[model samples]
Target: MSLLREAERCIANQGSHATLNALITTLQHLGPWLERVRDADTRRTQGTSKSAVDGRLIAIKDNICTRDLPTTCASNALDKFTSPFNATAVQQLEEAGAIVAGKSNLDEFGMGSHSINSRFGPVRSLRRNRDGESLSAGGSSGGSAVAVATAQCYAALGTDTGGSVRLPAAYTGTVGFKPSYGLISRWGVVAYANSLDTVGIIGKDVSSVREVFGVVNRPDSRDPTSLSSFTRSRIDSHLRSPALAARATSPLKIGVPLEYNISELSPSVLRAWSRSLAYMRRQGHTIHPVSLPTTTLALSAYYVLAPAEASSNLAKYDGVRYGTRSEGPNSATFPSGYLYASTRGVGFGSEVKRRILLGAFSLSADAMDNYFIQAQRVRRLVQHDFDAVFRAHQPIASGQPETNTNPEKDAVDVLICPTAPSSPPRISSLMDHNPRASPLDAYMNDVFTVPASLAGLPAISVPVTVESTIDSRDADLAGIQVIGQYGDDSLVLKVAELLDGRHL
Candidate 1:
């Protein structure tokens, strides 16, 4: 079917799903591409295409730039901004004949755990089992998750700085895959944290996500931090090793991080995790308890490091360059600095400003050594801890011998854990009553998901069954996260497929 026809079908059947009301923007932005469906048809018929993703409809998170559409990052500051060029991933998709459907809404600059921070409004969950109580589709990537869950697009791209993509997928009953950092280029993605930000994929299942990944995983010259060809080859070699290849085909050992069983885990989530492990064991995979000792400190280090990088990345948004400009009442009295201050003060949301200020304070000379530097050290420790647990070595370009090895010990193929500590909270509860919840409490939502992100490893969230008394009308979905070594994306998807009882 043509992309246009798929879009029409989506429009026709959209009401069947309970999606976020503020999901789509103007459809006019997609008109030119919609008119060229025949071009995609021609490419498909020609059959000798170099691009694996030809003729697909892809949804983009609001933060991913597309020359033809607005890249708002769900922030008021960039509300009127549109990029002059496509993001590296977008360009690759288009080259492969994928039609850009429309930009999906998201938490402001990928900040919130719920899609509530969007300027367009919160993205509602689509998991309506039957009494339509609104549930949060996990945040930052909530709109992307909802878009995929509702079949608004075949696959949607999201950015996972923390658990943005994985959490939403867990909440909405979809597949969310965060590739190893630097595997996919991030040249045109609006920066939240340059180091931690990674483009992720959300789809109805793991196969769809793998198909999209195959198209966009090439290194891009535009992304300075993209992994080099040398590193890619190294990762491939590790995966191709005869013993590793054999393990990949058979039921391999999977580790359940001991620290993930925290007090915050809901009974439903705990039950689901246990059930998933039991199912894996029944399938012959060994489930073992693993220790990631540094995990307790990951949230704190991430909050500091991510914001610190964000503070530096966002400095370009002064009134003189990009983003909104606000004229202070006393602009004439202080022409130079007041405009910038007023612009940022008025344009940025409260949470964003709060983060920016916190980041700036941490980077200040007084706190640099004590906070920022210490946070960096903790970040390294977090990565080190992951490296110690994973079987495969990170393919660094320097050609250094892989160290920290325990020859007698064998590492598990993948790590299994809960995607989020609990089920989705009511949007109203989060907005109105959760004011007493500290920022730290909010950050904890990504605790189980971040260590993989920090380590630049691929991870996926797959929805598992949960027994609930909450009305059947409200779809109560939860997920278990499966993490793989770098470049082991295929294995992760296979495991998710096995657990979800979907054909791989």
Candidate 2:
């Protein structure tokens, strides 16, 4: 949190609009927002309690509901729309005295990977090269990540259905923590994928994210998907073993998934991965090789399942029942269904349209078993792979614990790997469809991140630099991801601290 104050001071002293412009969403009026916070603080009643985040200026991803600011997901579909209530997460922060900095930008409907599929225009990066060339800020939570990176806010809220939070954190070299699904309530947030969508926190470092996570990680009755007290007790009882407690101060077992060492991994990333592993080994943590065979199929299954869910979730926005109605007639003819068609046609962006079509097709009777069912099967397999590799069992499942017969060869405490295959590509390359970058190219960035999302595991991304210098050495600093079993968020953040902070 202090780092954010330092960033504010730096901005004030330097007067760097370039840094601010690359991050601020043009559709909203945003700034340090100190005056608002001070006014609210003065109105506080005596004996009113405040948590660690009191008086903190925080940014919310535009997708999250906020009563004060408009909740536009950088898409025309919900443009200039204001919610009457705040997201549970937002409400919790405000209760703790955190002020809204602004609603940062994101991909339209949380669809695109590069934040360019927005009516508000793509989110620009604060990262620049020797020639002052711009780079990507990642997406669909790119703007939230950039806000934290530029020191525009103490921490920002983002959603990660499939690496939306992690990828941006990696690209911008900030800390992004995607807690196990259901840890934070998602009731007020716009739905992307009901099952997979998770509200995440982005900060300059692990401490900020940890603090934010502490404030918001609680169950809410509004969100049926939110973890219940019974589930929390289950998670606690399952993980409160003496062995787990003993490992707190002991060396850890870190797994290096062989499948993640794909051919597409850049040399810079490879080097950073190797060095981080070496560092852990030197710290006495055993580095073991593990395999999640379904890793490669995760992205494919995610696209199928997520779109299928999106199609169902977005059905309400027909302009008649939900979306913005057009002033003009529905169509030239066929007045009955024209309103629905025309409103959706104009309201949704190309990417949103594409996913909806794909989702509808997958859910069709002819393709349901072949596509949607198959994708669900793949998702289950992905989850099974993680379960098989983790030392702990699922919090809610009733089963005999899987015994690690060999103490020296037990399941890993965590999996350490690169967050993305390569450093962020230049923004120009991502925007243009030249041979260097195509429409499909952005999807590849999520290759390393989708598996964790599919499995609902706790994952954290922290910046780690490579020892050997290479091309684009500055940007070569990559995010090393630490993933743990479900409900192992504390351990995941503990490892994130080890990698990013002086304290272990």
Candidate 3:
């Protein structure tokens, strides 16, 4: 089909799926995207062939910058803001012939797990509970996952800072890929946690996610943290080595992190997890029960560290510099201090404000040692725990041997686990009036996905269908995460495809 035709079809789907609120802005906001599709169609008619992703429509999360569209972050603070230039990832994809469908809704500054904290309202899941109540699509990247799930777009871009992308994909029954840190440029993405934040891809399948990743996973001069070409070449070389190649073609060593089998896991999710592992075992792969003792501390450490970084990153939005300025008589008097106070008080949502406050306290002189600094130490231990079990040596960090020697016989090539602790939670359960709901309960959603983010490793969440006895739904889906050593993205995607039964 022509690019323009595909874009039109997606736009039509977006209108029909309006109840999901997957996109914050739609037809009216897609002028630039339509122009791009038209140009791509013109080029195609002229007999020009380009990238595999060319002519495909992809959704951009609100936090990612797009020059032509308002980059709201789903917060009133920047609700009307538009970037002067496109984000590096967005530009790279467009250069490769992809079209930006529109900006999707998100948690205010990507702060919440349920995506209910957005100024634009919550993103509803395509899936529902046994009671027939709507379910959360999962946060921060909830809208992107929904867009892909409902065929509103071919794929979508989401920023995963501690499993934002993966969790949403799990809820929405889509595939989400969070590539290794520094592989994708973060130049234009709004920061949540500098250390843990990563640009991720959500699509209907692993192949689609992999294709999108290939286009934007290049070193960018604008992003200081982006991995250098030399480092990338070294990683590529390591993967092509005889030992790695032999392991790739042969039966694999997959790890099952015992730490992830928490009591909070629902019965349905646990059953799905076992089914996924059993499928891999049937394919002749070995499953080794690995211990990542530090895994238990990862979630707590992430909250502290992410909020601290967020407080720093969000400080620039004090109305004077970036955020929306308040209206009324007191708004203009900067020396009076009312301007910054009123603007922010009215601009930020409850969840964003709560995080900002938590962050502020952690960074305070009296609390830094007990909180922020301790979190940093825990983060390091988390990284160490991952390095201990993976056979592939870290390419960026020298001094470590090329391959692990300790527990070498049991070292795993990849680890498989649940992406979220449970299936999609009921949307009503996240509301303020719910007596059972609390911030702590919301934080538990990230328990399974945070360890991989803290380690800066590559991970992908693939949807698995399991038999369901709930009403007439017939089947329920769970997200199974496949994690690999830093820079082992290709291997991780391969395993995800295998579990998806593509290779079988």
Candidate 4:
């Protein structure tokens, strides 16, 4: 079929609303890529068969480079920055026949938890509830989540450093999948933190998420961090599954973390969690009580380690080298390096500045052993805790399996828990939160999702229902997370599918 005919077919399936605003997305950077699609179709007709995302619209986060659009990290520091190259992920999407709809907004340098840190504006979480007020779309990938939820595109790509991708999925009630670190290539993506970064996929359903994941999960010769094929095979050999049965129908042993049952967790979230566990047990899955004692230290270690890496990565943005400059009282002293100081003072946002300072402090000579070294030790313990509980052995390790600390019969296959501590909070409340509790309260949002990140494991968040007694305005509710050991992404996604449903 002709390219125009294919475009028309996609529009027909989406109905009037989707057709009218097909190219307009959360952040307005570039659009209506009709020419790009025509070019792709011409190549397709002359060359080979179509791909999974042929003629589909997809949104790329602003942090990921695109030759056609500006690659601002949603901060004025790079307001005029446009890459001369396309990120490896974007190149893969185009090769698979997907068209770039536009670039989405995000927290400045992927910093904030809620999506309000952008210079462009905050991403508002909207739905069909017939209300004018919009709650937060979770951050640093908030705009990507909103784009998928509104059907602005077939799917979108987000980079998860901490809980950027999964937390937004929980708030917006969409499917967010963060593949195991190194599974997806990171070439040409602007660095936030080198070790923790993973390219994630967000879609309206698990099927779409899985389809897109298949296309990008390949070894990239250009990316130094991309996992080699040999390592991937070894990990697959250690995966847990019944003798010859496919994992989809096999009964699972799901772990519920005892530490997540804290005083701060809301009553509504607790009820929803209880209901999800009850439903899973009815389906004949075994439920086990588990403990990761290092889980409590996860948040503190992440803040230190992420900031330290970020400080080093962002050092190149001195006005003379990378970022834009600003006029100041000391502008006349350009050669003295004072102008670089003036430009950065005006360019960076409050949150970015805060993290950069904290990161720098952690890496300083006087504080290295006390802060940086201790944080590194804690990160290792977090990974060890995860390896000890799963049935499959850690492929990265060459020796025998580590001793299991749990007294249960065997290691659980997957860990299931609430994605967030509570439902989406009203925008008004967050803006007016007490001064003392503001930033710390925001940091707590990632508390449940960060453990998997520190371990470099694959994790996903799928929406589940909340209690009826909660107000109708609270309809957005919370999500349930399923985390798997390294290379166990397929099973993690399957468990999420089995658990997805409305209130039981």
**Which is the leading candidate under lDDT?**
3
Candidate 3, residues 241-293, lDDT tens digits: the string is 78788886699999999999999889878988888888889989998999999
Candidate 4, residues 452-481, lDDT tens digits: the string is 999998899988876566565454367888
TM-score attained by model 3: 0.95
Cα lDDT for residue 475, candidate 2 = 35
User: In order, what lDDT does every prediction score?
Assistant: 0.79, 0.81, 0.89, 0.79
User: Which digits, one per residue and each the tens of the lDDT, describe model 1 over residues 1-504?
Assistant: 664577666544444543465354534644566656656666667875546566666889989999987888888788678899999999989887777767888888888888887777788875542356687888889988988888877888999998899999988889999998899999999999988999999988888898899989998888998987887887888778776778756778888889899998998788788878888898998887788898888888888888888888888887668887776663334654365777777677767877888899999999999999998888778777776676666556255345327341557778999999988776766663476655565677888888887777899999887555565543245788999877788788888888763211
The residue-level lDDT of candidate 3 at 186 comes to 96
Off by over 4 Å in 2: 1-49, 331-337, 398-408, 432-437, 470-475, 501-504
Residue clash pairs of candidate 3: none
- lDDT value, candidate 4, whole model: 0.79
Candidate 1 colliding pairs, count: 4
Model 1 scores worst on lDDT over the 10 consecutive residues at 399-408
Tell me how candidate 3 scores on lDDT. 0.89
The local distance difference test score of model 2 is 0.81
Off by over 4 Å in 1: 1-4, 13-19, 22-26, 29-32, 39-52, 128-132, 330-332, 335-337, 397-404, 407-410, 432-438, 467-476, 501-504
